[model samples]
Target: MKLTVCSSVLLLLLTFSFCHGGNIFVFPAEGSHWINMDILLQALHSRGHNITILRSTRSWYIKANASYYNALSMPVEKSIDETFITNLMKAGVQFVLGTTPWLSSINILTKMVDIITYLHSAVCELVSAVLDDAALMKTLEDTKFDLVLSDPCWGGGVILAKYMKLPLVYYVRWQIGEDAHFGIAPSPLSYIPVTGSGFTDRMTFLQRVKNMILYLVTYIQNDVISGRLYQPTCAKYLGPDCDFNQIKTDADIWLMRTDFVFDYPRPTMPNVVYIGGFQCKPAKPLPEHLEEFVQSSGEHGVVIMPMGTFVSELPDDMANGIAAALAKLPQKVIWRYKGKRPASVGNNTLVVDWMPQNDLLGHPKIKLFVAHGGTNGVHEAIYHGVPVAGLPMYFDQYDNLLRLQERGGAKIVSISTVDKDDSFLEAMQEVLTDPSYRENMQRLSRLHRDQPVEPMDKALFWIEFVMRHKGAAHLKAQSYNMSWFTYHSVDVVLFLTAAVLLVLLTSFMFIRCLFRALCKRKVKRE
Candidate 1:
């Protein structure tokens, strides 16, 4: 009787959840970006929501068939894959390896631009395919999704949401090659450093000058590319006057993948909800082999290098040098690498193709993290309170690691000098031996966990909040539709300046006339 009663209760609960569930449409980017998106989709599915993901026929990471969500593919000629990543890594490596200033700057000119330029061009192709498909558009419209959830890293989703006329929510940290905040918020360049500048919030006069120049570079880049690449798509599908940047900022909610614990304090908007470490959860038990390996360390703890999935292998020489360095450590090392075995690798180290990164990081025996400084990795480190010895590969890695270093939870080693000298080894030793690094990271972990609601729950609440209301227009800023002249109050400034100048000129003319009249009266009297 009790068993039947429990079963009936479970069925009723499931029915209730299903009845209240929403239907969501998701447009996601590939690579590590998809990983977190997938996590959120899983949670939404568990809550009994129906999810449909839009993808490219050429997508390498995004799966067509998944239990959590249904997928709709847009056929396209070009796609992003490991080849792009390998080439990008090569260019980035060359850029860092360049000894001469001209050589380094040339890499910046040639391949540095290739990173975003190529990615966006491919994205534009997919966007074109999706819009050109009238049948697909009809199907999407008929479905009548509650909202469009997207990663604005690729601008295609933003354009799609505009076309569908649905509420838009962003699972975002970046937009194109720059941080998304610059597109929406009031960022004072004097203190708020631009993305990829590798500078902190506090800056000297010279640094601020550098900051302004970089900000202009980003502005020019955004304008040139939007006009050249995305404007045509918008003109065709989203109407002639529909500005792409305006559509980007018009997003109803920004589920920002950062919080104050992991990021420096800065200006924010009412619609931007910070959900840093939302992907993180308490550790689960490790696989038997991994647990046994971890236990073998005994009195000494383990050091894990949890590099994200981009790197399959490293150059043999560089690998050997890293292995040699690790060989000297007293602690055991578990490296996640798919490359050929290095000759100098120590007996203390175990390298594998994959790892339960969060599970291992949360282990009591795990002491240090050798990281590549991806956003997910950084957040996981903070969540698990593991000190990092960062090997920043490329893109925003340096900037991400620098934030933690400023907080005294991590130390960065130059990738260029890592293989050449003892820098990598020394960095590892410092983070491992110094208690301050661990203590600081633990403190951050406590602060992150002390919040009333979990970041992930907060993210879900806001997403549902949009769905319930049809949109969050009240929270959105009106600046998106404002022209540059109007948004910055440039016209108002010009008018004010003109008024001040007019008043000063009038006073000057009156004084000159009075003086001249006084002189004439004096002469006549004489």
Candidate 2:
């Protein structure tokens, strides 16, 4: 009877906790955001958790594109200080955030905050800004988060998690980090400076040294600058016990928003979870106009031209060039141009500021993606097994385009020098005619689709697992402690050298002994 009563009490407590356990707060990258996050939000909601979204106005594309010129320039720490705490308080969350800093590089110049400042300059700025905020510390004290989800780029996410006494889980929308490259040999392709294009796998002796030195320099710089900002916040709210270095070292969990197929022949970390295409949901019925457009575009297929959110001001020359090129093609073009359509466009060319991008990508009739090669766009193209022609403008786009070209699934045309007319037309013609591109894409798609679980589920499962297990320390890699020579294990080389030396010594001794014996025999015989 006593045992039964205790068991009943335990069950009741668990039930109560499940019913009222804190909600999940998602702080996404600004201006209402990318496509995959929606899937994550929906998944959380479906799992019976309450969800709140906090996003900044500055986006990933702000620096490169003029549209975000006004928004990006505003200090992020000021913006974050103004909004994040108030929103979290209002939502009554236990705490959760995706990545950190809407613009990390932009915040670096202000010296107001310290942010994780990833590979990009904007990331540095954002990290600097967040570290500077006073209110954020108070908020962390007031409502302690159980976990914080961060974009892999926002190295500061882990920092914030430590400050809040929460577990840090990196959320990647792309490939896994270098530590995770066990199964996949790093490809020789050097796309984005270090992270993109599998460069981690092919890093040479000198490159590794340079990378380590650079990483140490940046880490020290950020730590010192950001530590100064944290001093005030800690003095006011966290009671000086908060050590930023301790927090920096504890980032172990990573939740990737990438699918396995999209990041083929790539390395991954144990903590890294690939959840690309997580945002894909069942398609809603196309709007009447969109349906008619798709239907009218003959079976030869349609090409989607999406420049993405940041590049709103499409040049008239570029539009006219595309229009002129499309007029000569048999395929229908569904161009996503935010600006006015040029007069040169033919009747078959459909111009809209935005279309349901994923739906269009999934469309059976759509064959080509004329893209700016943003990570999201690249993922979508690969998800649907569609070939792409990248009009790369900045950042990782060059790397993404390079990866595509290497895979034989896409072609790249740099916007800096290529003429708007003949060059664009010729590239499109090549992609359309080339069967190899389509075949490679299809192969990738199949691999991506064969994953055992959906990316969101995998993410959530690991998140809950962290909560249940209090950080899977068992799964964490100790590579940070291993020296470069040790991690790669130079002992093998030493062993081979020793074996060769021993063999040579033995052969010399044997030959010398034989020669001495021959001389002795000759002397004795004589």
Candidate 3:
């Protein structure tokens, strides 16, 4: 009887342990972005998986926006905190890593179990943009990642993955190179042409060419720099004999969070999966005050003017221009102004510090969106079938707005042009009253929302897929080895032809010398 009782108790304990799945650790560079990851964690937890987030000891936002003079007040990046380890123990994270830039103490966790690092942004700046700190490179080497997932930020991670002999997957969070974007002109490259303040025009032909040249140079530079960064790191960790490029393509997948509908580009490889809208979820209802405000707008609907988080302060002239434009519009306008509101507030105008964004866009009375063309904002606008008037600031916003325009759902106005009352009014009029824009947005919305799976679920599915397959190598890009000139085989063929020409030229020169000598000998004999 005692033996049977002991056996029963042991079986119960085993069942209890199995019920709680192993740990998953997350490190986020941006605090606000934690929400999206949190959603993913919640879903996993509901499925009986335990997870924990290891936030930066300090905040990325604070570093990004703090006054220059006060910058010294910012906390220096430190070794991993003990709190992170404590949380790891509680959550049972058998696997760990987050958006690259792992904390220095990450090695402590890696010593405990395997690590999976997710690259959200391509480290494009690491090559020529930022100082290549050797000590940082050594730290990356010490992590000994089992798998690396890359997003568009394309720098250090790509190279690290190569050197580490770890599986790599390049995943794009937004549409890469599309032929013609909706709101802007098209480019062959996946990203938009980056424009700086030095440019005289909004976009110049020379600027485009420069951008194209930079694109290729960046790709080559990325590979070379990545190779340099990782080769040494891998040698230190995994020994000197690591086959840096031997990481299989199947082991690395180029997963894009874009659907075929958003980008009409044909898939070149099975590994390059166009899974757009992977993070989208059904938007919930707005707060009572917000809902009432939308209901008050009546049939014409409300125009949502949100410039996004990066640029909350609008110039006085720009604010005045927007207010002037809103006054003329028949629809009620809810402007999410971060700074002071304009003195010329119209009867239909409503200014708030921060509005519930997703909820506001999802409101039935919210017809048109005035955005700064951020990707997240664009995605939210598309998910809600709302047409946008984009004043793209910089980065992917230019390209994102272009795609939205290409879909016929959005319009772009230069801040310089719309900084005046007349232009802002004209642009707002076009977006708000135009039936074509509405139709286009609705059409695209159907495509984005009609996906078989929700974005969060798909993200979790891919995350789990990586865990299950030990690394989805099939999706990695093959262009890693195929250098621009080599990939096209132009340099190799050209080199061979050059060699042949050189050989022919040398033989001709030798014959000429021999012929001259023979003529001289004959003359001497005579």
TM-score of each: 0.95, 0.66, 0.64
10 residues in a row with least lDDT, candidate 2: 90-99
lDDT (C-alpha, whole model) for all candidates:
0.87, 0.58, 0.55
- Which should have the higher lDDT, number 1 or number 3? 1
Which lDDT tens digits does candidate 3 get at residues 1-526?
Answer: 9999999999999888756343332322232333343444566666555443323334333232222111112222432233433333322222211213455346545543321121212122222121245664464456443355443232334444554455655444421222212111223433344322112123467776776676566445434543554445445444586533333222345555556555444325545555465555567888788778888887888998876343334456656766777878888888877666677769998888788788788777888899986656777787888899987654456667777787798888766555444776787788887899989988888878776777656665666666557676465445544534775689889999999999999999999999999999999999
- Number of clashing residue pairs, candidate 2: 33
Off by over 4 Å in 3: 1-22, 25-27, 31-38, 52-54, 60-75, 78-171, 174-211, 214-251, 264-268, 474-478, 481-485, 495-526
Return model 3's CA RMSD, one decimal: 12.8
lDDT of 1 by residue, 300-397 (tens): 89999876353444567777888889889999999887777888989999989889898998999999999999999999999999999998877789
lDDT of 3: 0.55
User: Cα deviation of 107 in candidate 2 (Å)?
Assistant: 19
Which candidate would rank higher by TM-score, 2 or 3?
Answer: 2
Q: Point out the higher-scoring one by TM-score: 1 or 3.
A: 1
- Number of clashing pairs per prediction, in order: 0, 33, 38
What order do candidates take by TM-score, descending?
1, 2, 3
